[model samples]
Target: MKILVFSMATIMKDVSMGGSQRHLRELLFHLADQGHQITVLTNRRQDNSEEYELCPGVQVLPILRFKETFPIPYDTHPFHLAHSYSLIRQYADTHDVFYIHDAQMDYGYLHANIPTVASIKNFVYPEAMISAFHTNRNYLIVSCDYMYSCIQYTVGRVQPQITDQLRIVKNGVDLSVYKPVEATRKSQLGLTDDDFVLLFPHRPEASKGIVQAFETVRELKEKLKGPLKGQLKGKARVRLLLPRHFDVHVSKETEQFYTQLTQEAKEFQVEESLVFYPWVPGHDMPQLYAIADVTLCIGQFIESFGYVQIESIACGTPVVVSNVGAQRSIVPSGYSVIKVDYGDTESTVEAIAELASTPMDITGVRQFLDQNYNYKENLLGYEELITSAGKGSSSVFSNTSLKSGSPMDVSYKLAPWCYVSGPKKGIYHDYFYTYLNQHELYSFLSTCTEESFSQMELVEAGVSSEAIEKAIEDGILVLYTP
Candidate 1:
């Protein structure tokens, strides 16, 4: 079968965008191995490469950029949607099935009148969720039950109508790369045998709980300085390893948050306990996971599917995860997975102290992961869905007419706010929330209402191109036809 995949983001190696991208890469590799021809039409990376071969035979084309205007976030953005429609018209005839990576991208596929299967890897916006339910396709693969529940909650009572389309295909990890391995980076990373290392392998986002890790470490230090000092002789140092950056797309707000976190750590007198680890590419993540005594996935960030927990467990590392979202559903009764409440600092510290002395027996967890979270089983689930979506499809390019000069095509405007009664200094939409200087940001967006500014015009207005680019990526400033 010939497959055409449409996504806003797809990377071959450096997976800084997290598990969703990895999930797509693995699925395409599996399909390619099974003799299906796959071509990916995705956004260009920072380096601006035109084409790539993800594998030996699978082709990846970076052609999803907004050509007529500056790029914006992908959810129903007119430029992106129109661009997607234009591309689908070109390739719809040759591909057997259209595999869309995000539910928000369903608009183009729905109107194409072709066999389409979409994966809801993240929380779908209300607009996209409503639009997707109006589709004629039968297959809508959600990553886990949590995402399914989110979509249902977003759609309210009418969810029953779309229930037939929502299929739960739990995320999986490749055992070949994530299995138990020797701790090869302990000494190289300046760790001694007496040190207890906790790998907080998450982005520097506040929701990912870097502050919670710091608080837990500070409390652990107090415990060690007192009565617990004599009990654990060899465990003198407790370090929480946090990566500095997840990707090159670090926003200014993230930088500010990270800076504030470090300052707070110093104020709490726990700066020595925090070790900011360098960025590790996705391919070297197993080695990074192997060096840690415990993996921390505790935070307010509700995961659609907690890939970190399963991936850490797959490497024979015990995980302390928040009791929320798919993390709780995926590994309910495993000793390797210790669940704590979102902000329970005392409990998290206690859990870390207990794990410092005791080594977990991950045999049962390994067996469980092999049966459920193995990549092969995951491949089969998606393979079945893709094949089913392709069955009895005979027409393509059936609906090529689009709103060519619609208001969404001419200029740029502020995307709709997800919350109107919320804070005035922040932009909250989809999965991102970044506080901004109201005077600087609001004035710029207000000016955009009059007319779109070119790159030079923006510079002349004293707005940095970086700020506009960031706003575009954040969906705060979007392409508008008028």
Candidate 2:
């Protein structure tokens, strides 16, 4: 099969460290190994490269239009949707099937003739679900049960027709590469055998809970000097291992963010316990995990799937994860993984302290991982779905097309998830599965009609002139014509 995969993540050292990016690369390589022809369409790196082979066979064609805005901020910039649409239009004809790594950018192939399957690897943003429900061409694939549940709650509630298009494919890890390690690189990392090392194996972003991790490290230091000191073998020293440097050139925003993080550590008086390290390549992450006493995955970031925590467990290390989002589903047995509430510094410190004396049950944890999150099973799942989707249909979208009319003559109605609710007059955007009090925008949408109406009719119907224009601009009122 000739497959075309679209991902914003480039095949670069800095970008490949992310879990979703790695998942895309692994799947492409696996399909190539099975004799399926695959070509990946991704953003060009800032350094400006055209095309390269991701593996020995799978071709990676980078879209040069994205070079200037390499890390396109989708929320702030319009290029994310525009570039995605343009890219799909340019290349959709040649490929038999389309696989998109990000559901948020799935707008491009909504009306494409070929089968398109897109994956959701983040907190189920409403825009993503809305895009999925708006089309029949795309199959919304989620990585965990939690993501599936998120969709089932919002979109599924409004549009039961989307049931056939939803799929759950669990994320997996390579056991051989991320296996148990008998020895740790303590001496090399300038740490003793006795020091309690807690690894924060994530990007140094505030959203990733870097600030909360810093506060926890400070509290851990205080605990070690008190009653918890006896639980350790030697001197009670707590080290919070953080990845400070990166392989790619740091942007001004990133540099400022890191500097602010460091400043916070100093303010908390835990600067002494903070151990900053340069970036470790993805291949060497197992070694990094093995050396830490407990890997910290606690933070404010709503994880779609906890890959770092799973990898830490597979590497024979216990993990302390925030009890939120998909982290709970990673280890159902709760064998080697410890759950703590997000922002609860005391519980986080205690979990790490408990693991100091009692080592993780590597044997049981590895068994659970092999049975559930094995990389082979993940690859095979994608293989089956893509093959079935490619052969099943020639025309993927519904027959319905927008009726051609003037801008004001286009029919507009409330989105399936959107409606006016309660005795109060307001427009609700069910994007987050909740009603928002948008009174001004509600004015026009409340008067929305399934049948076409001219602008003069809407104004004559007592709809505020400002509300009508705002509704059209915000997409609260959909139109078939420009």
The C-alpha lDDT values of all candidates are 0.67, 0.69
Task: For each candidate, give its TM-score against the true structure.
Answer: 0.74, 0.77
lDDT tens per residue, model 1, 1-482: 88888766545454535677777887888899899999888766455456878886589887765332112344346776676668766776788888878655665544365688888765534434554554455577877766775554444233344565677887778878887888888777778778777899886667777778888778877888885684443578888787876443434555676789889889878888777767765668888888788899987675778789888888887788866556657787545777776667888877766665666677777778787777787889999988877885322222122234633234544543321111344333434533343533565554454535454555567777687678666655554323
Clashing residue pairs in candidate 1 are 407-481, 408-481, 409-481, 410-481, 411-480
Question: How close to the true structure is residue 242 of candidate 1, measured as C-alpha lDDT?
Answer: 77
The residue-level lDDT of candidate 1 at 251 comes to: 47
Task: Please provide, for model 2 over 1-482, each residue's C-alpha lDDT reduced to its tens digit, 9 standing for 90 to 100.
Answer: 98878775566533464777778878888999998888777766555366777677688877634433323335344665576567676777888888877654555444367787777777444545456565555467788776775555445434544546777888888988898665566777788776778899787567677887888888877777887776755557888888864533635666776778778888988888877777776667888887788899887566778799889888888888875567756676457777865667888887876666676678888888888887899999888888778887423434333235665654454443345554252554423323446565455556565434556666777777687777655545544221
lDDT, model 2, position 368: 86
Q: Which ten residues in a row have the lowest lDDT in candidate 1?
A: 393-402
Q: 308, model 2: CA deviation in Å? A: 1.1
Q: Which stretches of candidate 1 lie over 4 Å from their true place?
A: 13-16, 66-72, 75-81, 108-111, 124-136, 153-156, 230-233, 249-254, 393-482
- Prediction 2 global C-alpha lDDT: 0.69
Model 2 misses residue 314 by how many Å?
0.8
